[model samples]
Target: MSKTVTFVILLLLVIKTSVVCRAQCSQGAIICETFGSGPRGLLPQGITNFTYRARACPDDGEYTLLDTVSGDCHGQAWHPILEDHTPNDVRGNMFVVNASYQPSEFYSQKVAGLCPGVIYEFSLWALNLNRILTAGACDEYILRNPIIAMRIEQPDGTLIKEIIQPAITRTATPIWVSLSMQFSIPTSSNDIVVKLVNKGLGGCGNDLVIDDIGFRPVHPGLSIQFSNSPDAETTVCADTRLSLTVGTATGYISPAYLWQQSQDNVTWTAIPNATLSTYAINPVRPGRTYYRLRNTQSINASAVGRAQCSAESNVLVVNGLPDSPFSLGPDQVLCEGTTQAIPAPTSLPAGTTFVWSDQSKSQNLTVSLAGTYWLETNFNGCTYRDSVIVESQNCRLDDIYVPDAFTPNNDTHNDQLVVFHAGAFLTYSFRVFDRWGNLIFVSRQIDVSWDGTFLNRPCSDGIYAWTADYSVLNPLNQTHHFVRSGRVMLVR
Candidate 1:
């Protein structure tokens, strides 16, 4: 081989591998191609056999890159695609191709820099872009389905794997489907050429749109959860410990692990001696912390924290609350007949809740009796308590009133004798007598009155003596009993 011939061959090889892209993938998988962004022009020369078109629609043996698909084709026989298959991509481009009249290679690219002896996955998203109907045809099986052959070859053109994908048939609506194959890079080769060859001829159908082509390592999923909590995110008091566990992962012959911590989710630090499926977090400081697990092969220690080489678990967030600073005030004094409101706790964490000794969650506790009142606040699996001692004292006295004179002339004014007192009366009794000491009127009821008549006969209207006994309660809840006598004049 001449020097110029070798140089030309190297140039062609470089062009073949230039289409391989390292885009984002699910869970750190490597997406080789997403057809670039919207308004993309054309593939570099030699990347595909099909001629490239700048327009939205392509004819037979031609292809194009478009963000969205619309308009009618072949008498409105094709389905319209509203978006590309790339996730979270508002205007990502997709490969739209119409097969040629004969079976031929349509796309080819050489993937390089693969890790040998590692399992890798090759996949793509495909959509059957045609919606054809056969006259009176059942099962909608009128048009020719799209079929393609995924061929993998070593750099020396040695075949490694070939998968004949099933024919993508037409449906009532356009749907994007996924097709994938897994392989291990042989020890002798670290690069391979991937080729997509059309297996069906183009005519009334066999049209398809392809997007999100990927070539990545096959890693088992890693999901981290709190061992004691059903939720991944939780709050804890200051200086609290936590236990975390990862879902069982398969596929690695000798799995290695490392536990990592982060103040914010963006930056991570590996924990010393924390290499297992489960990890116990030490007492966390005040603030938010995040945790995750990284898994790789035991032989690949250097790649343990590298996302492209290791499988990372789902992030677990822990919000650490600072120590609570609050007081319920000093011992309080209350009167027996009065109530006082104890203020509620303020400036506590979001999830903190409290309950009083009476099992009430009201904003404040109303206390009237002398006792010990307590409040217990529960926050992030911890409890705090405070109490106040209440004492009662006598503050006011009960008063009583008795009439001095009355005339039972049936004029409706001053016709009877009555007794009155404040509402503190607990027990009462009254009696009336003439000057000869005869019990003319006796009563035990507080509201009863005397009319200056006994046995339906009018008595001589003279001074009458009245005796009464009663008990009254003060503000201190203590009852006081007293006996008294008074004279009343009655005239008819």
Candidate 2:
């Protein structure tokens, strides 16, 4: 053969081999069937075989091939039996299996041309047709109870897995239920059989309709990790910025991101316009909020298949300074010569530091003098302050005087003798004695006076010795006692 012809032929052979290998190594195929074909087309292509029994007449023996619509067997009009239908099957023709014909009936199909060792998911929609038949009537003859089972079998008919659905009692209104299962293809087996079986007795109400069966390969290892964010339970000041980044992703060709937030850590809502791997939050609110990133990975390079995963970042707590700490109670009045302690709020946030106006680190302040007092608190880089005025009143006995002369004759001019201006005294006493040093008058009241008489009788006019004693409160809240004595001339 010529050299050019030989080269061209070898290139063509290599190209063909490459194309075949690519097709073989590709993802598993998606097998989906809506089963909308009419009665004649019940055994559709790709399905291996099916077995069913139906009564020729209402009372006749069970035969193969029941009717398509569920309403046909019940002799009553019913809405379309299928829950959802494909665009091609808008009329929603479905496969109806009646337990009156056979106790157990099924449709089986062989899933061929699947990539070995790959994971695949299968799902189908099933409706209990018996509910519609028993609607608006109490028909005891109808047995509408049935259980659906999806079985995965080996080529030799050995059971690999059987997913038996929960028993469904017939209700007045029937609804479709979707069931799904995920399985991994065995490395040694490239093809398997899937069977949909109705496991119920041969009775009236055990009728079922099924549609929209699907099997597709899925990427099993889509995951994400969080990074470049604060640790969990971190406290930051309000209005601070928190930055987070997505670490890594697996089993995805093109991954997209969405940031979500939650207040109570339960109900989460997505943050709009946050679709990048890296996200930033500035001016966070005062309360605690939770954040997480949702990662969506496209299984194929063309973005045909998609898988989703999420990673929650550490929870960042935003804190602010507590309410002003200076509260001295309702009666802020401080008595003179007494020590008072100003109180502060005790519900401050953790890691908070307090400083008094006088630079004292204690939360409360004690003072004997009066002035304007204030406090400042710091928490999570935020500062709070409050102030109050401390008022003090002085009622001290600083001066006292006694008149040197008095007349008790009732002329209304200097008619009695008394001490003048006795200020805020805790105790006081006054006494008047005759010139012979004999006591004639005494009083404990500071304002009381002697009328120059003894026992309500006029005393002989003469010089009398008088003495006064008193005590007053000092600035230190202590009593200071004093005594003064003098001679007073009594004229009548």
Candidate 3:
């Protein structure tokens, strides 16, 4: 094997040895042998060579299952353990054994249904039951500690992993210590046989209790430390770009690397082309973002295959920024007779402030007169600014139409003398005069027309003079006056 492979094995063993009860396999166990709740009994005949005892206390070369071990048993050679190590249980049985006078293989089980090339953790909880003193309270003698060899092997007797557990010596207070080992199944093997061989000689104090044996897949122990900060979480200004450097990565060997990011922490997406150990982002969009490094040890470059056997580093959080950057759009024109409304964004984070050029505090800015307009958005103590130009367009400078003659004989067609203007006028007046200069018809509104009537009586059909005066806005939005006169012939 290569040196990198050797280092990986040694590092895995060293890291797993220090973990306590809390560090069970996070991925669920495939082989959970709790010796679960049942009537006090022994394992099946073919499973182990140890004889079965029906009582609470088992003698030498014997094993039994019970929920609790009484203090009166075996002349109080073992601790009175109340319950098994199974979590969240009212009554659970623990396998209690007394080593024989000679060394022997005491426990064996065939584990199957495992995926090849995947790493697995084999672990169990053990408590040394030997009392501090011998049978007599006044007599002090050396007690025999229970030492066992944990082994994993192929069904054909090929050894895969074997380690001698340190002797479980008598402590002042009996507590369960977790013993765990990590190994990967080779492609040639799909099933394994696990064995426990007692190394301690049967004696006055070689009894122990076992519970919660587990076998589950585990990810490699991949980790990283930040270069600039010691914490996993930090803050960045909204206006500045974010740059992160991984100071130290555990065993930067031949493993393939891929970086991932998450917005909600539940769903993660792989960063594109981010295969290096360092990352830099400019104009970092706001919000809380999480990043992590994933390491895969594989010869194949397939993404799905790599993800199956990948290890992820601890998540690094960058938090407390504003919303993403926004644009105010291109410059626009506002007609003289119309109003335009520009609204500030309301979905920004709390305490966000918006300031317009005119010092208006409302969420919407309404304007008629045109000029340059700008806004400053402040969030998380950072400011973003954008400006836009608003120029004026005259609405009343378009063409107007007036007919020179009309037939006001009460028919729908050509019955009224109406003036039409395409553009809006600020002020208007129209009047019709008789040949003798008498005011026959008058109107101040643009749409109102003269229907050839005066004082509710029809006027005589004749030629008459008319005049119109109106004020309209010019290109500079200034009002300009115009007067026009025309002679219209009113026919019956």
Candidate 4:
């Protein structure tokens, strides 16, 4: 939500320094070759001085540059995934700025058809130049200028544009200088080469090393932004994943990321596994929640300076669902005082028992009360205790029963069909018709009723007929009831 700029002397201008290091994939799981002068190379002079290091984060599995002396470039390595621009130091590579006498296509890859543009930004430490590349002032192939040229091609195998710049640092110590160039790409399938050419690597000769090579879209100016949403909230479940999108200008610089979560926002718990762009929320209370990101490194900060990271996404309230049913049965609501006899589970063919507001584990038990209750029984491979609620009845009669027969023949007393029942059935259903038999009225559950009318008008006095349906359990396992039907008379 806010912005700040920082500068780091990650690229040093140390000259003729005796530095050595070892580089490898995270966990030292894989080993690769390093650049420089001395023992390793086919050339007689040999390559040594520069080392592939597992600096500061050897244990965490990240590696970066290591200066032998107490210079500005000392620190852990960072590889910030950027958009619309290239990375800053690229971790282990030197930011050397070497100049050249002139620009030529010799070091440039030839453009085949249409070409995409590439932006290259590299910095050089002034001091460690002569030590890495095996070229110099007297070398004819090597330009007198410290600037080096490298070519990047398109996938179609054509020359893009040729990007050339002076080695990083050179004489500028502690100052972070960078070179950015956008080379038009070739219209071919293969990318332009950054290594070899017809004329001595376009002056790059033996060393113009690089590390973080980001190839992404380029966003300009103020659009460089970052966002995290819905702040924070509690969850009932144990696992959750959050999202984050960061905005950057000039692409992104040495940006480091860290996520921390906490039960009480005051003291955050650093979730080791919840990392990078998003945090995977884990087990916590089912109510309120809190989270935040610590900006270990920001895109606009100086290399040596550190700043407090922004607050994490807004609070997200999570409501977890029950993983397993409370008791071994499905949850359902029953009408209060409705004696729904429990029906032993059919799945447990061996037969099951029940427990409720009663003392018997009997196969059948009447639901004489209303409230959430649990049932315990061993079946199949596991035991289950179903937790359920029984709703209180709105009336003494949970439903209505109707018997056929009602005369609409101008009879004042027996003209309307009516429903009548006891305190047991939890639901009611009924339908009525005239002597001519046209359906005139109906009712379901406790919602609505009828007054013997057809198409919104009253029926002539006559005998009417009707049918009603209701439900009832076996009084043992509380299984669903089979349909029961009856008839009633409409009387006025």
Candidate 5:
């Protein structure tokens, strides 16, 4: 045989192998086809025959098979018409259609071996051939805009439903565009027909190519449940073993697992080598840590099957308590007969019990008498204790003295009017007024004294009427009020 005949035979064999591979479904996929078959029926080499035909074609059949490197029917090269190489064309071959050739033409196939009543997703990649095949002759009549329609029909040729109408627009470049839709198969139907139609008028630019068609069944939803060994919020000592369990009520096909840990309980990171349903943590740290499980897998099987299908388990927190209970506060003082309550540590772990020094099991201790108080926290078969000291004061009031005369002559002695023994009172107020009853001085502090001045200016020496009101704590811890009035001589 000649070299030319040998090359042609080799090419035919290669194309056949590609078509067989493309027709096979991927793992976990039901149906897939790349249209890599060589010329057989109405289509030329590299096109698959359609199952049914609706509209007629003027030049060729409803669809034609074309290689991206090959030109139009005139055999012109199509490199100038395409912007970049087709990204979605996993295989170099695809099926092409022109709507202007007739009213409209579609390539369809009957899909078999599907689970009844199960949801299945169908998807394919399409590209618009925007380059003009001829010059200005057919340019005016050609419509470059294109729309592709996808539909599902019963085996009897009746339209079951429109999966996708004329909605997808083709771009100017030969870039492959993806389209997909999900539908549930009817219980009575054993097979469904899928159609891909080019809805653009094809005088000049309404050329489209479709490839990499696929269909698959997938789970609708994902849910995960978690279980902890000692239960959530369990308190344990350092170096204790903790077990976390994760499971799914609806076991999806071949789901992946990942366990995550968090310190602040907000930001989380996956644990190393923790890809399993159960995770174990030995020698826990001396702080709080959170754990959760995540499951991910491929779902909604279609062109976008690799889209994220993930579910996360609920969070479980385990607290590690210290060997000794931490103190809530330092030693404190309380007035005599005044009650004081010591608060318990808020960091105490779960499953921990509190015991007061007075044989009480409450979280806090309230005492009216002055003495030392302590708290004991028990957790994880161990006991820890902390203490606090409380003191009381005895306050009494005998008498209060107010100076009636003062010499403000630049000498320190008797330079201001003042009150003495005022500290014995709980609350007191002193006010001095001029003879005209206009208030000149006022103070609430017991040690407050007034210089013979108003607004920082010395006042005339005169007798200023003064009034004092004070309260003292009696032996019963009740307030007793007293009012006294006198005259003070301000001799500047």
Candidate 6:
């Protein structure tokens, strides 16, 4: 083929394969599509001194668009019902869950300027509600965000709380309510969790749109610091050493490090040579507690530390659950072809991950096959664990059996034999033969007893040979195999 022709043919072949592979993919999975930016969907960007017609304080705006199937879609407002609506009026995005806050996008495109102490102001047209049906549909969502969590926050002055945004109802003409909030952190938070939120509904994962998010400034020393981190307050196995980080300022470099922690954040105790980037949170106590970094220099422009450092990383919380205490839940046998969900509790402070002894992460599982299962959850800190077991549906075998040897001599008792499964379908075959590999009587699913009949009536008993065949699984991948051969005796 010519170069041009070859390239065209190859390109066509590649495109054809790509399309077929995605045939069962999401693009093909969508059953329906609709478009309506809700009362929250109204954009205020174009009109300065925007004009609108609202008859009441909590008025549903006029000249707005919304969906009949989905409720008021908007951003900026506190949705009372926590539905996943795009409040930003952006056409393409959906809502998703994080533990604390219900955010706007699953793939929230980078907001370019997200950093420490920066205050981001949220702005969007919120939907005025209660005009629409506040009552939930029969198909309200069932949440499903199951995660192994580790959250780091300087919860000191920063009001760091997980948020679940409500889904709002739709009204006539869909009125818009504008809502706004701000968040700022002075320092970095370790163990910051990036996770998903389950809406608990039938999977209504909604994400909204966000615009005009910016950083606002706060004062100095307003930042509180934590020293002995990740294990802010954790149960450590005997003699397990703890480590916490000491931070320098956002802009400047500190000459040295000083670590001070308290049995409480109050009454102070100092570690003699704890001058380093990370300190050993020692003289470890029992039960719950807190710790903070001691700055050698005062945290002010005129003083050394504020010019040098301010906030410690977000506080780390470690819980020391009892040693090797195993846990498991969803204690039920799952049905075939359906998934059963099992939840891991947050009670175990040390355990960080889960493993099925059989290597399955099936917190929720479809018991398609029968197997013995166990769950092993681990502690990321010191190697500790908790584990449990699960059982699956049983499989059955087909019965097919017949007598190897039989004497049809008008004998009454102990004359014949057969095999069968207690409750199931059956298939069978039986045969009798002489030593020369000649078949005497052979039949499949033979219901009548063999009477040692070569043709009919009784026959003589000798070392006559025979063959029997039946079906059963080999316990492997459940394949079918046949067994053949044997010898039998007939008596007169």
lDDT of the candidates, in the order given? 0.73, 0.56, 0.69, 0.36, 0.58, 0.36
Better of 2 and 6 by TM-score: 2
Q: How close is candidate 3 to the true structure, as a TM-score?
A: 0.49
What lDDT tens digits, residue by residue, belong to model 2 across residues 1-492?
000000000011111121211121223325454544435333433332233334321221222223244444445523334333334454544445433345343456666544443456676666665544434443554443667676777778877677877765555665766667777655566567777665655545554555565555665433223344334455555555666665545544455566777888767687877877677776556767777665534322221212112223333433422332335445466767899888777877667788888999975699788788887777756766777787776444555778888887888999899788524778888988897889999899976889888998999888999888888877787888888899988999
TM agreement with the true structure for every prediction: 0.51, 0.35, 0.49, 0.32, 0.36, 0.20
TM-score of 4: 0.32
Better of 3 and 4 by TM-score: 3
Give the lDDT of residue 446 in candidate 4.
35
On TM-score, the leading prediction is 1
Best by lDDT: 1
lDDT of 4 by residue, 296-338 (tens): 2243222111111121233334444323223334544566546
Error of 1 at 420 (Å): 97
lDDT of 1 by residue, 425-473 (tens): 6788889999999998987877788888988898887898999888887
Q: Flag the better candidate by lDDT, 1 or 6.
A: 1
Candidate 5 residue lDDT tens string, 399-420: 6677778998877888878787
- For candidate 3, give the lDDT: 0.69
Residue-pair clashes per prediction, in order, are 0, 4, 0, 122, 3, 42
lDDT of 6: 0.36
Give the residue spans of candidate 4 off by over 4 A: 1-33, 36-147, 153-161, 166-328, 332-387, 391-400, 403-488
345, model 1: CA deviation in Å?
A: 28
Runs of candidate 6 exceeding 4 Å displacement: 1-52, 55-243, 247-282, 288-315, 318-492
Q: Residue 21 lDDT in model 3?
A: 28
Q: lDDT for model 4, on a 0 to 1 scale?
A: 0.36
- Residue-by-residue lDDT tens digits, candidate 6, 90-164: 442221111122322111111221234433232232333322223344125432221111111342323343343
- Candidate 1 vs candidate 4, TM-score winner: 1
